[model samples]
Target: MTLIRSLAAALLLACALPASADIFKCTDPISGKVTYTNTKIGEKGCTLLSKDQNVSAVPANGAKKPAASPTDFPKVDNSTQRARDNDRRKILETELASEERALESAKKELAEQESMRSGGERNFSRVQERVKPFQDQVELHERNVEAIRAEIAKLR
Candidate 1:
């Protein structure tokens, strides 16, 4: 892949005139060297720019070039974006399940506290201490789920 990209870059640079195009810095993937170029070439698998193969790039100084990432090039599709959305959905589903479980547990504890009060046990301070932490946990889960739900909606 590295050799192919370099040769393609060299060919493209050869076709690119010395004074006409902007030099783009491309690099070899195998080696972490920096490649300096005056052409917007080889970034997109050397297929996007179709300038005639008759011109050439101005020679480089001495700096090594790095391999061209997809970022160095551009593509038209929702592939990467969709993958991110799916990952986000998976994460949110796990979080939502956790929150629901906590909420259920909290509701049960609150109900138990109420039952104790009806059974002639009126020491409310200890009941509150037991329920407060669960209440806080449920609230925190609700808040987080809401925030994540909002973000997921935006992805749609």
Candidate 2:
């Protein structure tokens, strides 16, 4: 019984303490832009803005007041949310498929270009000129594939 009382007292004391946060203000000299952060300012030109403490009053009965609900907030039903998520997934999958096909085509074209380089174009500059466009196409397709995959991964 004594341990339970002591624990309850400790919890009440913790709840009664005010919450405090340290705020730091930083300014960029060149851009004249100001930024605030919760961390201490380690830069030479930054300043400690303020320490803010939030205190809430406890009722005499020691009960919390009921929160008022806002009527104007928009809400979506679970079915609607699921439908939107399904549509998003379908779009992302379609894009991924298209990107994958483009990547395969680019790889095939690059291989073809590699095989077509003749012994007549033995000069290094001629060889580079012939290979550069194919290499660029392959790189572009690879980047597209990666970007599509990332988008698909981000969807719910």
Question: What is the Å distance of residue 116 in model 2 from its true position?
Answer: 1.1
Sliding window of 10 residues with minimal summed lDDT for model 2: 52-61
Residues 1-156, model 1: lDDT tens digits? 346879997887567544454435556666656654545545542222333333343335655466577765866469887887889888877877877787787778767755654443366786676668767766876776677677667666
Model 2 misplaced regions, further than 4 Å: 1-74
TM-score for each predicted model, relative to the true structure: 0.41, 0.51
Q: Candidate 1 at residue 77, lDDT? A: 69
N/CA/C clash count, model 1: 15
Q: How many residue pairs collide in each prediction?
A: 15, 0
lDDT by residue (tens digit), candidate 2, 10-115: 7987778665767677877778777766665556657877777453445546875776778987889999999998998898788878878888898898899877
Range of the 10 consecutive residues with the lowest summed lDDT in candidate 1: 45-54
